[model samples]
Target: MLPRPSRLTLPSIARWARLNGSSSRAASGGVTLLPTQEPTPEANATLTEEEFSSMIIHGRSIYPPLYHPRTHSVPVAQLQFRAYQHQFLDLYMHFVGHAAAALGIPISRPVYLPTQRSLWTVPRGPFVHKKSQENFERKVHKRAIKAWDADPEVVDRWVRYITRHAMPGVGLRVTQWKRAPLGIGQQMVDSAVGQTRLGSGAVKVKALAEKIVQQELLVEENADTATR
Candidate 1:
């Protein structure tokens, strides 16, 4: 079967309602229908037929627009979901897409991975009845969602939201990439030096190094004096 048609936006729906003159005063207050002239019988019939056909073909429902990743070079978080049921996986992915949009995170289209199938066979009765066997198979469905140009905190929240409301039988895995400045290591070391825990250890190491250097210098001076 062909995939369901894309959903119509709110404005489109309101415009259609206005054109059909089915809009109520409370619902369409201040919103005006086009042409202001009465639509002819033939035109109205054709429009109604077309709208009915569209509703039937499109399943008579609407959804939010799909989000596109904002940046390709920036770091991103990849969320992978796995489930045994394909329908549930698709529904969960749609929910995730909506959530991502709500969080203002740019996301790419869900990439459907190849289905994995495994089969097992076991004897129905005893080993003597090996010829009579039962066969069982399992299929795993997978989908990948990539979100880009998202703040780290926002990504964390998104993950937490999904985790909190996760559906049963769905498995989620998240991989995040963090991009840091070139001198981050030095910055981390410098920052660690002033910390309560790392600072004491660093100070102790520095003192030990200085003491070793001083002892080596005295040993060299004594050798030089003996030579003199």
Candidate 2:
């Protein structure tokens, strides 16, 4: 008779079974946190101590240390998108790609830098797993209350999101503007108008900012020639 499957062996078998069972369900590819193949000597070349230390501390991709230096050679401008909008970030990334395509900009080697943003992110909910509907609702209410009060967790998430997406785009957009100001300004203006804002007088400021962005009119060096 075959031996019974012990608990130790059961988990492995169960996991394998689940993976094989779901293999045909859909083709959602997985991300390998660890590299499958060893890095080549070129890729693994010794970075300076500062580079190695900083990269490890910040949880950055070690493979591409060339991005920052490259930015200097290619003009990079800084931009800030002040708010708590992850959805906007996703949409803006897509918009940037589409705009890049239209303007014949090369995006094959684009790098995203998020270390220089100034917003914070709060947790969406609790730490429970496979929670019931009631529990989920309670968690959401708690989070919502905390976020309303400007909870530290909420602030952290917002800061992280902006840091990662906005910084890189600042440079990218500035370069694009220099190449095609009229087109880029119009795009920015449309984006600013569609964006959500809060508080008294916020709407007016948003509109004004949109106009300035759309017209590329920051300094009034040629005020007489421009329409306000």
Q: For this target, which candidate reaches the highest lDDT against the unseen true structure?
A: 1
TM for every model, in the order presented, reads 0.59, 0.19
lDDT of 1 by residue, 1-228 (tens): 235342333234434554555454345784444444443444443343223332421222346434744865465799999999988888778778867776778888889899999999988998789799999999999999888898889999989998898988899999998778799999888787767566668778888999999999999999999999
lDDT of each: 0.72, 0.36
What is candidate 1's TM-score against the reference?
0.59
Rate residue 184 of model 1 by lDDT. 95
- Clashes in model 1: which pairs? none
Q: In model 1, what lDDT does residue 156 have?
A: 93
Those runs of model 1 whose alpha carbons end farther than 4 Å from true positions after fitting are: 1-9, 12-64, 181-183, 189-228
Per-residue lDDT of 184-210 in model 2, one digit per residue for the tens?
Answer: 888877677667444446878989889
